[model samples]
Target: MKKTIYKKIHIIGSVGSGKTTLAKEISSLLGIPYYELDNVVWIRNKSGDIRRTEQEREEYLNSILQSDNWIIEGIHNEDWVSNCFQSADLIIFLDTNYLVRTYRIIKRFLKQKLRIEKANYKPTLDIFFKMFKWNRHFEEVGKVNFFNKYVVHKDKIKVINNAKCIKKYFN
Candidate 1:
């Protein structure tokens, strides 16, 4: 198998599309640090998860971008994260089927609530329902918007529509 030479990687996908899982796997395989966009966007405070200002978010991302090699993964396609996409040696876009993603989202939430798995945020019913809404939004709107925005970087983008295809990357 050919070894992946990419030093800086970015992954974007709909909720439960396995972006985090793939990022972690690639990080372990390449021994590169992995950062989550959600963590950068929201800071955990004594009160709860408070969203950082746009300037704060940019500053947080800048710190990660300064690193020589990193893997960043999230579902965001906002302007604030465009720099990450531009800097990445490889961009992974997971397009898993809606049914599969929905299943994973439900399973993941249950696991997080049961303390079987760890998550960046506290699992609540509100967030759980929002995941479904986000999933739909990604399928209907975000996918088109992402393709449109990143059309210039088509060469660097790897669109993985099947879950099994991702296994080959690590192997």
Candidate 2:
């Protein structure tokens, strides 16, 4: 068996862009632990999701970064996670089309509501709609900035445009 070269992988993209799914798949293939950023930022309980404080979030993130191998996936490209980008051995940027992302967001929400799919948070209508808004925000603002910010690390960055591209990475 061939060994995977990347020990610490970071995946980022717009909502419904399949960042988490791909992260899970790659983690399984590489036998690396996976961490979802949503899990780091929000604590789910009987009432709802309680946001973690900046310090708490940072501490949690630091613990993961200290580990030898991991695959961290999220839509977050903020200053708080810049360290992950800097430390990652590989960074995957999923760039599926907006239409595909919109469809995925709706499909995922329905699945979550019907208990056909698992989600980190409750599948409320507001959260469903916010997914679209977040997708658009990434398309208009976040995408370009992300590329620009990580241009220096272009050699380590992989832009996945479709499912085939994702499979190629592991195969």
Candidate 3:
């Protein structure tokens, strides 16, 4: 089988959708830099408050898009990111089952709390509760409407429905 070669890839999905994990795996396999969009969007403090500025976010995203080969993963699909997608060889949308994603989210939170996996910022119970809202947004607003409106390269888009397919896609 001929392997897929994507020089610039964008992974977009909701919270708990495994976007970051999949992006990192794909980036390692393809030998490309992986960027977490949340890192660009929010400035983390040692005290745990996340400050987000649109201008700073834009600049950060601009720097990443200027790179040759990158895997950018995030839930934000604004105009700037959409422009970056124009050059993306592949755009993956992970629509894994809600129960699976919820479990992953909880597992990640516990891992983060245990210091097993370090996040850009600490994950709190408040953030855990917010996952419910994020999941709803992804289902009702983000995925369907955003894809319909902005995702122009239908041929390049791949929607993975499960973790098994995610591994298969990269393999």
Q: Model 1 reaches what TM-score against the true structure?
A: 0.94
Give the candidates in order of TM-score, highest first: 2, 1, 3
Model 2: residue 158 alpha-carbon error in angstroms? 0.5
Worst 10 residues of 2 by lDDT: 162-171
Q: lDDT tens string, model 3, 10-127?
A: 8888888888888878877889999887788777788775756778888888888889889998888777578667778888888888888778888888999999988776687888
Q: Number of backbone collisions per candidate, in order?
A: 0, 0, 0
RMSD (Å) of each candidate, 1 decimal: 1.7, 1.8, 2.1
Cα shift from native, residue 62, model 2 (Å): 0.3
Show model 2 residue runs off by greater than 4 Å: 1-4
Best TM-score among the predictions, by candidate number: 2
Candidate 2 residue lDDT tens string, 45-131 = 878889999999999999999999899999998889999999999999999999999999999999999999988888999999888
Worst 10 residues of 3 by lDDT: 162-171
Selected candidate, larger lDDT, 1 vs 2? 1
| Model 1 spans > 4 angstroms off | 1-4
| Native-to-model Cα distance after best TM-score fit, residue 102 in candidate 3, in Å | 1.2
TM-score for candidate 2, please give it: 0.95
Q: List per-prediction Cα lDDT, in the order shown.
A: 0.92, 0.90, 0.81
Kindly list the per-residue Cα lDDT of model 1 for residues 1-171, writing each as its tens digit. Answer: 557688999999999999988888888888999999999999976568999999999999999999999999999998889999999999999999999999999999999999999878889999999999999999999999999999888999999997578777666
Return whichever of 1 and 3 wins on TM-score.
1
Candidate 3 lDDT score relative to the true structure: 0.81
